[model samples]
Target: MRVETVQLKGYTTLGVGGPAELWTVETPEDLKEAAQAPYRVLGNGSNLLVSDQGVPERVIKLGGVFTAWDLNLTPRNGAYITGWIGAGAMLPLLVQEAARKGLSGLEGLLGIPATVGGAVRMNAGTRYGEIADALEVVEVFHDGQLRHYRPEELGFAYRTSHLPPGGIVTRVRFRLTPSTPKAVREKMALVDQARKGQPKKKSAGCAFKNPPGDSAGRLIDVHGLKGLREGQAMVSLEHGNFIVNLGGATARDVWRLVQRIRSVIPLELEWEVWGVIE
Candidate 1:
């Protein structure tokens, strides 16, 4: 609805970035009206490494009608617990709600940070599970038209869901397993306990997707890269996959570090480390 210069730090979980110039749209109608312009969507900014130079155009972010969630329990066919979840609903909140409603599947996804749409798009999850497993269908708006993709049609990959290119997710329908609330809470607590010792400050979850059997953090740690610093950006000592911004880090510093890591890993182990950045 309103366009302006945005400091990337405010939106990202990493607390590092520069700026995005142009309007930010909060509604689908607003997005449609400005469809002629080049744009990108930003969610809760959990898993992104923004450029220091910033994107040169509009970044449409859905809000308002975009952020509602509805839960339904169908008694037919073994108590199917379906949730019509909004794109902007926070992932943690969804997990919390699911646990409250006796949904067993989302317990492993407790500490993730992002809107439901972003989680669905990226297929965010831990080693134990991923969001796509429980997704039934997702509603998206693309090229001024609305469409729905069932789980089978969505093309769930390692960390990607093959939604139509340029499609903005509006809502997700998830069919969850019915379990006792106590059982769900216990599982959630286990996930929480695992996350408790990790640094809780600014971070973008895991910086790199794991390379099959090997973890990115383990690789970086083996290289003696823990607490490695460049300007204010430092690879976290506790978790090598995370790059922490100690107060005043720039996107360039983070990008340079990522480049350095990628270039060095192969030279050290003769193994390629692939990752995505935006």
Candidate 2:
């Protein structure tokens, strides 16, 4: 029943927002109660854009009690390992955990900043990888109850998981093939290296999903939108698809820049770009 004001700019990766009325949920029961409070669920706050006017609504953020990790080995499929990871667990932590356990599937998502729940919702991935591929089942809370959904039921697709909107993922089970820990580490290092080449400042990761057979950054770069700035929000000089906060960026600034890019790209190069913004 505790309500606090949140400085959302500090809470999000974008670093540009006002404040939210927030409540911290420490347990599933707490989450259930908070979910009924007309608030948006806030996970690691990486893939969202908040209005500068701020989130006038209540926000529910879950904490570490939901971050448990468990592993079990199976005999039927050449040392398959099953990981039951909590939704509140950070993506990088889960990646490293799976790597340490000699599981080979999640190495491609090494440096992404988000929680498992967010990753499950967005099906977050790079060109060669996705979290949904390795998922066997997802435990979720919806409609005031908890349920498990198999992969087929999840309807996973590019950059999206087909959970009914507003459903909260509580845990995810992964099916992984066992490999040598050294091998897993090598693959993860490669992913880290690739990510290191991108902008590493205050950003909301990729601003646009790549269109089929082409890259979003390449298109934006071709249009010369890289390094474009408006009120402290700059289109990254290093990666066009990313807009970085340059000390005083606001949500309106970011939104305007995105619209400018989208408006020009279609007319100039006949390329369609869609951005996910709040």
Candidate 3:
């Protein structure tokens, strides 16, 4: 295990945050040991925004054994396949491997920078599909015990899951259909192309969940909030729902911009913002 006191900005995709006690665990044993105490589990940090004052609890990052995944093709009726993936595995890598094996399921998550655990916990998805759509079983460690859970048990919904508090997902099982590699690649390319309008800078993906059938980006854009700036953080001109960090932006800057949007937007819209602002 590697231990250090480091700035959270280095760990998050947003590139802004304060310092915290960080622990990198290489084995399941180490993870369990660390979990015995109150700690925050961080994955790829794609959808998180830590506070400027920094996190007070210990931060645990999975590595080594947690990243190892095995692909088992179990044939049933000779028409479909079942895949089991490690929770710590990267979503993009899993998509690539599935495509290579002529399997079709996770194409919609092509550009999302998240691990399986985080994706499943958030029911991460786009207009194409969600992780829960293909998820069959989730193996997680909770209260010092390892258990398997069905999708229904998770209460999956828009950008949220009812995973037991303090639970750590260790593996995921997906049900995929047989497909031609060409077709799989085409789907992935289509999703990639669709995301061209999204900002490519340092951002915590979408800043808020779309309200019902309405799009959050469209609402923010219509309100003329795009390109709005607070210190070094600015609402992305390309996508209104995203707030990008410009060089030395601090977490406070992003929080203030979010507050501005929330206060100015109509109250009936009922949109929920993502990230931890502290």
- Runs in model 1 deviating more than 4 A are 21-27, 75-81, 266-278
Which has the better lDDT: candidate 1, or candidate 3? 3
lDDT of each: 0.75, 0.79, 0.83
RMSD of each: 3.7, 3.6, 2.5
Q: Which has the greatest lDDT?
A: 3
Candidate 2 error regions (>4 Å): 74-83, 266-278
How accurate locally is residue 202 in candidate 2, as Cα lDDT from 0 to 100? 89
lDDT of 2: 0.79
Query: Model 2 — which ten-residue stretch has the worst lDDT?
Result: 267-276
Residue runs of model 3 more than 4 Å from their true location after superposition? 76-83, 266-278
Candidate 1 vs candidate 3: the TM-score winner is: 3
Record all residue pairs in model 1 with backbone atoms less than 3 Å apart, i.e. clashing: 1-26, 3-23
lDDT of 1 by residue, 10-90 (tens): 777777656775455667677687566777777888887766656665666767767778766654456464757889888
Instruction: Identify the candidate with maximal TM-score.
Output: 3
lDDT of 3 by residue, 45-84 (tens): 8878778778778888877777877666676655344656
